[model samples]
Target: MEKITLYYFLVNNKATLGLGENIKLLLEDAALEHEYVRLELDEAWNNKKVQLVKEGLYSGTLPYIEVGGKKFGRTVPIMRYISVKLGNKYHGANDEENQILDSAADIIGDWFESAKLAFNGSNEDKKKYVEVDTPRFLDIFERYLSAQEGPYILGEKISYSDFLIYHRLDDDMALDRLADYPNLTKFVQSFVERPNIKKHLASLSK
Candidate 1:
């Protein structure tokens, strides 16, 4: 099999902590060979890596990916594509469950995009993003989780959606009361104990 290459356009820890972390975890869990090359905006602009940026700028933003000499933008699509290729036991075992998992994955992608802007924006914009946007986003997700059964968004087996949601909630420190939603809390807790993810969590401090 030809090696798959992936370059994650990231800045600091925050960038890696969210979607970047999700993709990395997914890839590792699938035992898929990959690489992460951080894209430094300043260095790229100054050093004329803009062309490379442009090529990866399918959606004109970071978290973009280059795979097999082709650029793929948008997070969920990439995640799905990789999951299908790797034959990972994510997205669950059936069609209905897979759809639900995919929908939750979309929610996670939307929330992460909102967060990226919120964190990168000016103080005023940040306030609006935090106060207005986040609550709305979280409310939608909370309901989504409420509709599900225990220990996962879809219950029982973990899915791609779980990885995305768990990473966002845990990394952002946005969910205040996990106890309020016991199932979601337990789901996240279960993942937190996974070997690959646990190792990455520890590496966050270094």
Candidate 2:
């Protein structure tokens, strides 16, 4: 089989990982062979390489993937495609389960989008969102996790949703704010401590 190729920007910052890093983690967890094509964000966009990628997907987007002679853009769809290809249980057990998983992922995506806005919005807007909108979403996640047999989002099996939630919360939210929700805090802790995940994170720092 052909190796999966991921195209993403190389950043100098050690504090954050790009969206492609999540895909790299997924590939590691799935024990799949892959290669990365790291590009300087500015140069890639100005050059023909990124233009070719955009033409392939018909979208001007970064963090693209080429696997099995096909192209995928955007994080969520790429994750779903790879999970299915690797036969990872993360895709869920059936269509209904997959739908449930997709719903959770979409909600998480929305939360992060709102978070970005909150970070850049006016002081009053930020305060309203952090004090009001943020907790509302956190409550939804907490309630869902509390009701489930977790450690994970769905149940006994660790799915992409678990990684999705963990990455966003760990990367985007302040640790102090996470204290109010013990389940979410624990969820992020457990996720980071997983053997493969732990190793992957350590490698990033180096």
Say which candidate scores most in lDDT. 2
Q: Estimate each model's TM-score.
A: 0.76, 0.84
How would you encode candidate 1's per-residue C-alpha lDDT over 53-91 as one tens digit per residue?
556564455455566677665566677777776675675
Best by the TM-score measure: 2
What TM-score does structure 1 among the candidates reach? 0.76
- Report the C-alpha lDDT of model 2 over 3-58, residue by residue, as the tens digit: 88988877554334557666777776766778887777665367755566556876
When summed lDDT is taken over every stretch of 10 residues in candidate 2, the lowest stretch is 11-20
Off by over 4 Å in 2: 11-15, 48-50, 53-55
